[model samples]
Target chain A: MSPLHLCLALSAALFCTGLVAVLIRGNAILVLLGVELMLNAANLNFLAFWRFGPGGGEAGLVFVLFSIAVAAAEAAVGMALVIAVHRHLRSIRIADANRLKG
Target chain B: MTTLLAVLALICLAPAVAAVLVRNLIHSALLFVLAWLGLAAFYLALGAEFVAFAQALVYVGGVSMVALFAVLLTRPGRTDLLPPPSAARAVGGLAAVSLVASMLASSLFWSRLPSMEPTAPIPLRRLGELLAGPYLVAVLLVGLILTVALIGGLLLAAPRRPAEGADA
Candidate 1:
């Protein structure tokens, strides 16, 4: 298989795994990890398209860098929220917290 | 080239699955670190040296640490890391994942994928120029966002001081 095809397949599989993780995991942290995995998979798609797409690939790199920055910020805020939730609920399981169920 | 790609695939995918599978939150976090490192390797394979370095530095050095810290701070006394999901939930997840995977595979196979290899590596100087030029606003915005997020996170995570009389 071509490198592009290989990368596309790899990224697709990873994205699926991440989605499953998100759907199944009860722990908020694990869910966060799943989100991160999904983000990485998307970034991989960008890089692959950039490498294999017509025209130049600089735009893809730029987008990837920006995405990484945004992801770091997201992780920070997400962990903070997780910590705050744990403080209030004393548990980190998603199934246990039902404050928003109403 | 194929060998390198295979190794990179292993590095990224295996630990990712393992991270989700492992019962220990700490182990999961560490395996995630490995997966992030593999992602950096993927960027390298694509010849984006700057991105690869940045990915390694940020995700591995920064985000993973933050996750570990969060895990430690919020740890329950005798809680299970791998909580059991219902059979229905597992089946739903599997179905959703498989559906998405099939769609992706079909799209990839149907498209006329181009194969333009990078003849030369993108220079750091050019990237800086682009970031400072047309993308300057985006660059500034990212910096602004990060700053705000950091301050907000600190405020949220900071220990609340008890009122003097209330505590006593």
Candidate 2:
């Protein structure tokens, strides 16, 4: 079996586990962790494809760098929002914030 | 190579599962850090040293800290950090994830992929050139986005004065 396939399989497994975490966990922070896992899975795929693809992986490296930067921004803003939600609602549970529901 | 892959896979996934299954939020968050470290190892195995270090610095050093701090800052008294998932809900999550994973693995077999070349790793110098050359605009935009996010995070998480909210 090709190493690429193994990497791809690993990425798939990580992504799936993240999906389960996002669905099964109630804590907003855990959900955020799940999202981080998903993002890392995607990043892994990028690296694998870049390595195994016909051309050089320069493009993939650049893309992964950009993705890392964006993920950092996303994590910062998401955590900040979580803190704000907790301040307003007194709880960080996703189900607890239902004030705007009709 | 295959053995390294196996070890890295175990390092990455075992903690991921533990992170999800663990009861304590702080422990789960730290487990997530271990998972990210495994991901960095994967990058290193692919011979992408620059990307791997960036992964460790950004995820391990930066994002994980933010998550842990979010957990610490928000929690006050003795309360449930993670309420257990209902039986039906847990089963559904497992079923859905398995379905998606099977679909993804099946699709990978349908296409004939190129074999990897044992080429030298991309140098950090070349990467810097690419960032400043063809990908300049994207790099600039990422910088702008990160700056905005930093400022926005500060604005959102800053404590408010009582006088400001007295009218409300």
Candidate 3:
């Protein structure tokens, strides 16, 4: 397989691992980490296509940069939410965070 | 070259798998940093030097610190072992993930991907121009969003004051 194919396959596998982590893990932080993994997988796909596809320009690179910034923002907000939830519930387990208001 | 890619893939994936499976929250967070570093290496291999550095700085540097801090701040006890998920939940999640993975792999293989030659990496200077020129609006928007998010995060994570003399 070409390097492009290899990159795509790796991205798919990473995405799948992330999905499983999100679905199975009880910890809110791990679930957030899983989301980060999925986002990174998507960024890898973008970089792969940009490297191999026609009309190679700066668009893909720019998009990935924006994506990285957004992902960082998401991580900040999500972690804050996790901390808030933990303060309220005294546990970071997703199952324990059943109530909407405390 | 293919063998190198295979090695890189192993480096990227193993820590991710271990992170998910490991019971300790701190270990899981650190393992994620390893996975991010592997991904940055992949970016370097792909000839996106700027992106690779940004990935290293932003992800491995910034986000991993955030994750580690969150993990530390929210740990319930001395030993941060997460309880094992229910067997049914684990099996079901694995089955669903595998189904999606198979579908993605089959589609990827069956599609006629263009066999294009790898292009020269864009100069960092040109990339900067594009960001300031055509993508200026997007850059501004991202900045705005990031500022808002940071402020929101601070507000959300701040300690609440106890109600004082409310009934008096």
Candidate 4:
């Protein structure tokens, strides 16, 4: 396979693994990790296209930088949410957090 | 080069799989760090040195610490007593994920992507100018969002005050 194809395949695999983790994992923190993995996969795709495609690639680089910053902010907020949930429920399991069931 | 890319792919993927499967939350978090490092290696191989270092700093350094802290704060003394997911739920989730993966893979292979020789890496100075000149608004917006998120996270995680009337 060409390098671009290789990168795309790797990105797809990583994204799928992350999806499985998010779908099956019970812990909220692990779910957040899955989200991070998916975000990284997208970043990989951007860099791959930037390297292999025509033009300056400036847009892709800037986009990845912004994406990384957003992911960091997301992790901070997500962890805080997880901590708050644990404080309230004394557990972080997704199955255990069902207070809003109506 | 293909062989090196394959190795990097393995490095990037294996820890991620292990992180999902591991029983200990702390171990899982650390495994995620390894996976992130592997992704940084991929960036380096792709010739994006700045992105590679940024990935290492933000993900391996910052995000890993956050994940570990969350795990520790939540777990405290109790080990993970949660039972494994029910067989039906696990099967359903796996099936859905597999279906999605297959679809994505098929589409990616079918599409006609334009391929060219890998280009020279953009200079660090040029990147700075683009960020400051054209993308300055986006940078400022990101700064605002980060500040807001920081304050919001602090508020959410802060300890609540006891009811004074009830105590009295």
Winning candidate number (DockQ): 3
Worst 10 residues of 1 chain A by lDDT: A49-58
Clashing pairs in 2: none
Decide which is better by DockQ, 2 or 4.
4
The digit string of per-residue lDDT tens for model 3 on B1-168 reads: 567878999999999999888988889989989999999998898889999899989988889999889988987787788889989988998899989999999998998888778888998899999999999999999999999999999999987875576466
The DockQ figures for the candidates are 0.75, 0.74, 0.82, 0.80
**Lowest-sum lDDT 10-residue window in model 2 chain B:** B159-168
Interface RMSD of each: 1.3, 1.5, 1.0, 1.1
lDDT of 4 by residue, B1-168 (tens): 678988999999999999888877888888999999999999998889999999999998899999888887887466744457678878998999999998999999898888789878999999999999999999999999999999999998877875467544
What's each prediction's clash count? 0, 0, 0, 0
**Native-contact fraction for each model?**
0.75, 0.78, 0.82, 0.81
lDDT of 2 at B156: 87
Per-residue lDDT of B55 in model 2: 95
lDDT for A10 (candidate 1): 88
Cα displacement (angstroms), candidate 3, residue B120, comes to 0.8
Model 3 ranges off by over 4 Å: B162-168
Q: Provide the TM-score for each candidate, comma-separated.
A: 0.93, 0.92, 0.95, 0.94
- Using TM-score as the measure, the top candidate is 3
lDDT of 3 by residue, A1-102 (tens): 888899899999899989988999978999999999999999999998899878655688789999999999999999999999999999988989987778
Candidate 2 per-residue lDDT, tens place, A1-102, comes to 677888888998899889988987877888988998999899888888788766666788789999999999999999998998998888887778878742
| Candidate 3, pairs of clashing residues | none
How is the predicted docking of candidate 3 categorized under the CAPRI scheme? high
Q: Judging by lDDT against the true structure, name the best candidate.
A: 3
